[model samples]
Target: MRLKNCLFIGCLSLMSLPALAETVNNLFQVREPVSGQTPDEKTRATQAALETLVTRLTGDAKAAQGATLAEVRKDPQQIISQYGYDAGPPESLQVDFDPASTERALRQAGLALWGSNRPVIMAWWLNDATDGANLVGDGQSSAEPLRRAAQHRGLPLRLPLADLGEQSIGNAKTLDGTDVAPLKQASERYGPDAILAVHAQENGSQWQGKWHLWLGDKMEQGSASGASAAELADAVLLSVSQRLAPRFVVKPGASSSMALEVQGMTLERYAQLVRLLEPFGGRLRSVNGDRVVFDVSGSVDQLRSQLSLARLQEVPAGEVGAAPVDAGQTPAVEAKPGSTNVSLPAGTADQTLHLRW
Candidate 1:
């Protein structure tokens, strides 16, 4: 199925720490429609934005009804860091919250924190409208509902171009089948982590949709019916989020430290590596030449799995010996004294990683 090579574009950009840090910092922002700049209007807008932020972070629609939300409502300013108005005839208010405080609030309420480094999904939508069967693509009106749903769920989605390459195999009949080769081929340019093939039909006032989700080697298919296109989009997004939430949700685990050795690392690569590890909440203990030590807050296996998702290839044990060090150049090798060594299976070694530029 050639699934192993399907790399999302966002994962490729994780090497840029400053850009990612900014994204994480602004992850909790929300905008609400406002009529006037009155005190009452601003307060209501802030509450609405807060509700949306809570739902977006937790991936749970009911998150705003919890005890933590009540705590937040008591003094919204405690968590909200900034607010501004958007210029419009019907103006809107934008609110930004303190990320640390908001995340702490979610943790205190026993909620899961879905990180901002989300996977991008490529959607192949075929609509059987009253006129005829047509493929939906970027900038098309039919794709608007799906885009809105993705924005609301904090999911990055790319619609197909339906050009000659896509049109050759993206017909409604082929999309209905289980074979993913065509979709996979068409999705190469987008570099999505997952692909969604959606077939929708409208009959009278009702909209019916059949969706197939391709996540790595796993495939899941389902059907949904809604009264309107917007409603159907919501249903599809809900199903997608339900399946993806577990993979992205950060679970609390025992804290552990590990020493990672990377060969052929330059100054820029080292900085990128450190930035990639920032989202894991790890503390950098030391950097001895090529070796970097971290006091991380999760199990070694879990960290390894996360790194694998980020495309860090593990070095085989057979090639794990010390590399040649230049004279007067400190070799990055071995953990510090008193540091614990983590053991893993032959093929699943996590102590050493090979950096591919």
Candidate 2:
């Protein structure tokens, strides 16, 4: 009997299977998919996935927070309107999503939200944000992702070239001289109204950020933090739009420049953004959000002439060419120098300078 038992053990050993086979078998062990997980699980997963996608695509921090997965699927507009946010165009939003995100949403979130008549841009920011595992990561230190996000319309606030140029550097350096005054001038030039300013601060544990909407110099809208650059943009738009409805109006008026800082690519892209404004006779100048504050003076005609003299007309489009605007067309506006600041109003807007985000 003992000999027979040994023989049996030997036979069992002879039929040995690889450990990897067991691992694969474990992987294939489908335990009924956790009951009603097919639909419900898909819903949760999609909502979680969509939160990142929308932020990356439209730079709105209040994407899913404004609408449930069900609400978003039925009608994103309902979500947009209810939340009072503008993503510009669906195609622009679509361009920022990752292909995998699009596929996952289609499979899980249903056709309502995922299926839209929009073109996708495959922005790296959207791709990274949609990756669920990375949702909690900090993006303030990242460059390419934010740049692509802003380009794809994921960012709501637009930065002038001068301000943008100041953002792209290794450290928080200040700008000086006439070279830095025009950007600040633009900000002051903005018509007395509410605006959004993005603030990124390192808080040891995580980044402290909020999309605050300003009215004159006071904060009119709410705040939302713990978001990506794209999400912050979206949140800013929602909060500002909602708040603006009560405090301001969207009129065809002039805007000076938008200022932003993202650890990098600001300086390099500043010229690019300046070029975008130059067409409207806007000029780029020193716009460091810290220290060395300055003022600027110039008119739309002056900026255009400067571009012309710089031979920007001959330079390729989408770049800040080196040309001086015709002195004759230049406006009498002057750039003043001062200190940089970040302050929001208390309640009213009379003498306040509200800082959003």
Candidate 3:
């Protein structure tokens, strides 16, 4: 009798196991992590972008979005704290330097390297322990001016190592501000073939450098400052260029000649896209009209494809109050006389190859 009772109990337990397992599976569904993603790098980029969005949405020009500058910064800050941000942690990477020497070397290095590549952003000596924007008290030079100088050389410059506050201010902490862990959450934000995160510092007179290249979270390749600063910067840039340098950044709906894909879209949007793409030659893999696959061909414009799109400044601004451009045009970022910065739409195949750091 006892044996029979024990067998009955065991059978019942076994019968219920499958149902329980199914229930658990639904509750704990696991998604493959973003195929090519990085939380830290993404967070930083997005944090920067979010700041930009705020300004574009609110600033003097007033973006189409109805948000005001203060509100623009505030709302995003709230979400950032929830998403691409976190409260202060106890670690730090603060190092001591001549400040002047470090800034000069970095600024010059940045100028010489990015001169022809991307547009200039603001530069200034870091002041507050936030966003690395400290402007040197003396105010002689900072990342901002050099960053601006780089832009003058013809890339669409954003703000530089210094005076980033003037670029697009947001609420970001410094000291422990790297926010690397958070940025790891959204790695694609940089929009580069290879996102280059480089660090240069004085290790008792000799500069030390480190770089990381990633296609999302997976670190592709990297090098430390074994070589000179120029060598280090050049090597990193070249590596990134090599990794992301495709003749064409193709997509599914891009063209027969391109390699890319599209997720879900509408017919009207597709038709509109077709109109926009009349200039390019590409292959369509499959077209439901509403959904399309394409193969875009050729290498993208090397400079534009890899780095952030920056427009040229015809007449550089000498001071803060001076409007960077003449009246009618609204001082657009992409319409510079000698430069261009276009925001083209995406391709199909849903395929993307990017750089994450």
Candidate 4:
């Protein structure tokens, strides 16, 4: 009887397990540069901020222009929790959207949403300037623009220390090559879920970058140009956000019911798993010893991605096989006296997935 039923309170509609990925905060807050403090300027910038927020939450570049969100675009102020201007070298207006209101509005519009529980990215950026080439370290002046852009794009970006050893590893060949072994080896200390390498150079007044990203077995490459380093960083990070969204985003009308059974379940792990599966609508079925069963709704891929964040490994077929459990139906687990195994009904393996942490 090591398992216990747990209560779960849903937070933002995002999926990142506590131990596996970093939980990003202030996702609903957005800041956009403004020309002046006039009412008209504020309105315009606020509207722009709303568009940026929508793009960040949805991970679609053109989502701001979708017809479904026309009403939200018309009255963006309804979701604003608070807004004000920041005084600085380049002034900006900051808007904080109400989480509950924003989530409701987006769901009502039938739009797919990406959660704030996202993977942390390690950025290995090399800036080739007229003076000399340098690596953007975590504590260097060159890192500010990248940090700002990462925050704006809702990416959890990390920078390397750029010591002599790391600088030797950050050469042009390592940054631009198809082989990621060298960069991956260098990023071992950073503990990021993904790695991004950028080879940027100053061409007269404009900055151009050729960037490559590696996550798991997949890789993405693109190029961007901007008038300044900040703009270039923003463009590159925006592209990264767009590329990463589809793998984790859950669409409104694209879900199916499935049964999930996890071994090594405890009360604490049960609570954590519940939060991780919030977006999938996980409902508990039964708890026996260190095992627990849950009925959840979502694609198998989505559920697999969510569970992986908690370091859960899927058991191979025919190894602790599962029987399908319908919606609102309890899984049939037969417990016999003095037996450690709970038997599952036969011939329903395809509809259920078995995993262990």
Candidate 5:
């Protein structure tokens, strides 16, 4: 079960928090092509699907084969909720893993899991075919492969409309250029948190792409080649997932418990805050006026990444009116009626963190 589920079960009514980043739905759902419907084939396909899911969630291509997940690989159905075969040009198996069970299992295995709240990626892809070079637009047929790739890798990808002005800016020079001013200017209208630029060319029947990803102050660039466009797209998205996961994934044993204070809390904001802090094992420490304190466990970067989703501002440690409050030093106050019990950790002044909602 998710840590939030443990803390809030039957305690407070839960509602979806307004997320700053796009929440990629169906992260646990995976589909892998199969050659036949035989029992052995289905079993093998199921294992392959589980491997794909583990890779997608942890951003480690070999996670499913790791010693930590050996038992899970032996009994793949332990966390699966449902499965069915999709009759396609290439037959495929669609597996839906129970999210809670899967999460619990992964945590128990000591693997770092990436949350569903992922950044929205705007992709500007320029394709060079034998006939000519063109940009892949939002409504174009060529964009379908990229969408499938994004979904398979659990990325929220968006394509521009490819209007005349955008096409002018989405050229080879702009895609390959180190300077992102032109691309960022064009991407502002799309409102994506990250920008992806790809220049793919088809030589004979093989496809290869040079890609660049820009997020915050970080920029990553790489090249990928595949037998076809679909394969190339999948390779590129997998690389992107690998790059993005480390920024958010909270590995086991890497977290330190600390006191966190969030000011400007109301009933509604409280609900939102709870959901946002779920991954950090956020436990209510106390409530004073609109300010609320929590005992949370995670790295500073991970906490900052999650709280940024709610537009929370971090108050410096020694601010005049915003000094960090040690939860242990604060007098104990009874939790509101029907609230679940959260054990407050023993903390000192230096172990406290503060934020403003």
Candidate 6:
């Protein structure tokens, strides 16, 4: 089989946080084919798009049936910011909603908001062909269906390069094996936030597959069957979203205030940090040098979990609240003999955190 390292240009551009953020900001957008730009057609399309956007943002397919959805339908224009037509033989209409208004509706509805800054999953897909089994790589035709499913679910998926270096780590044997260490090693180059291993086979008109996903130190595996490749891909996306929803979903409730010390604080870094935290309903209560206190709607544990997923490194407990340092400066301190610095446990209250960017 021919293995290539090329990735989709569009996919590669999403690697940066800024780019990812921009994409997430537009998560509420939807495009649908239309026969003509008639008033009735536009209205119907807008409503459909709004429903899709609500479901996509909440990760709950039934979110559209809720009270907030009713409010949106009552005055759809309240949430819709702009929309236009795309040139096509079968004309298509694109709708864009106001993010702030949509989010407020979600919060008022007491539903969780699955923000767009999601974890990037590196997927290793293997398919059984007539001649033999083939590994799916970047831009492979066979993988297009899976990519569309990922887009539908708003999940970002990257395929392996399957280069000589990757093959040396493991091949189909290691991928199909019970051990996942080799696959993890092979995935390091992509800097994935998580790893997914999927093996699919076609039986007549139906498709079946088993998949394994590793997020941080946790691992989950499942099997699915579908009537079509698209159906199978949607099933896979649903399973993956189930695993991710708990960690990323923002449920509504009373707000909580937490104190945190952030090392390496600068004017620019502080602004960036606020933007990152704003999605979680974080508001700055106070900022004294590197230490910050935030009034956030979510619990401290939830906040920590989200930050970790965002790639922020947790400063060792001893380092928390250590005097603020200027940009590009490191703190110099000698550890005491026979004294060990213990890192705070997960869910610890008011622990200090640091951003790696």
lDDT of each: 0.64, 0.28, 0.29, 0.79, 0.80, 0.63
Off by over 4 Å in 4: 5-19, 265-272, 322-350
Q: Tell me how many residue pairs clash in candidate 2.
A: 37
Which number leads on TM-score?
Answer: 4
* TM-score of each candidate structure, all chains considered together: 0.69, 0.26, 0.29, 0.85, 0.84, 0.70
How high is the lDDT of residue 14 in model 5? 43
Question: What's the distance in Å from true for residue 101, model 2?
Answer: 23
lDDT of 2 by residue, 46-101 (tens): 34435554533323445446433554555323322111112333211121234444
How many steric overlaps are in each model, in order? 1, 37, 80, 0, 0, 0
In model 2, the Cα lDDT at residue 17 comes to: 21
Ten contiguous residues minimizing lDDT sum, candidate 1: 1-10
lDDT per residue (tens digit) for residues 1-357 in model 4: 223423122112213324355667799999999999999999999889988998899898788888988988898989999998898546999999999999999888888788776778999999998999999999999999998899999999999999999999998889988788988999988888889999999999999999999877789999999999999999999999998887778787778777788887765566567666667656566655577777677788877766766778888777774432344333332221122223334322236778987
**Cα lDDT tens digits for candidate 3, 234-281:** 333433433432321332233333333333434333333222232233
The better-scoring model by lDDT among 2 and 4 is: 4
Q: What is the C-alpha RMSD of each candidate to the true structure, in Å?
A: 8.6, 26.2, 25.0, 6.3, 5.0, 11.1
User: Candidate 1: which pairs clash?
Assistant: 290-332
Q: Give the 10-residue window scoring lowest on summed lDDT in candidate 2.
A: 20-29
What's the true lDDT of residue 104 in model 2?
A: 44
Compute the lDDT for candidate 3: 0.29
When sorted by TM-score, best at the front, the candidate numbers are 4, 5, 6, 1, 3, 2
After superposition, which runs of candidate 5 have C-alpha atoms over 4 Å from their true positions?
Answer: 1-17, 263-272, 286-291, 309-313, 316-321, 326-350
Q: Per-residue CA lDDT of candidate 5, range 1-357, in tens?
A: 433333345234444435456778999999888998899999999998898899889988978898988999999899999998899645799999999999889889889898777788999999988899999999999999899899989999999999999999999999988788899999998888889999999999899999999887679999998899889999999999998888788778888888788877666566666666666766676656667777777898878866765668888656726544645443332233334454454444336667886
Q: lDDT-based ranking, best first? A: 5, 4, 1, 6, 3, 2
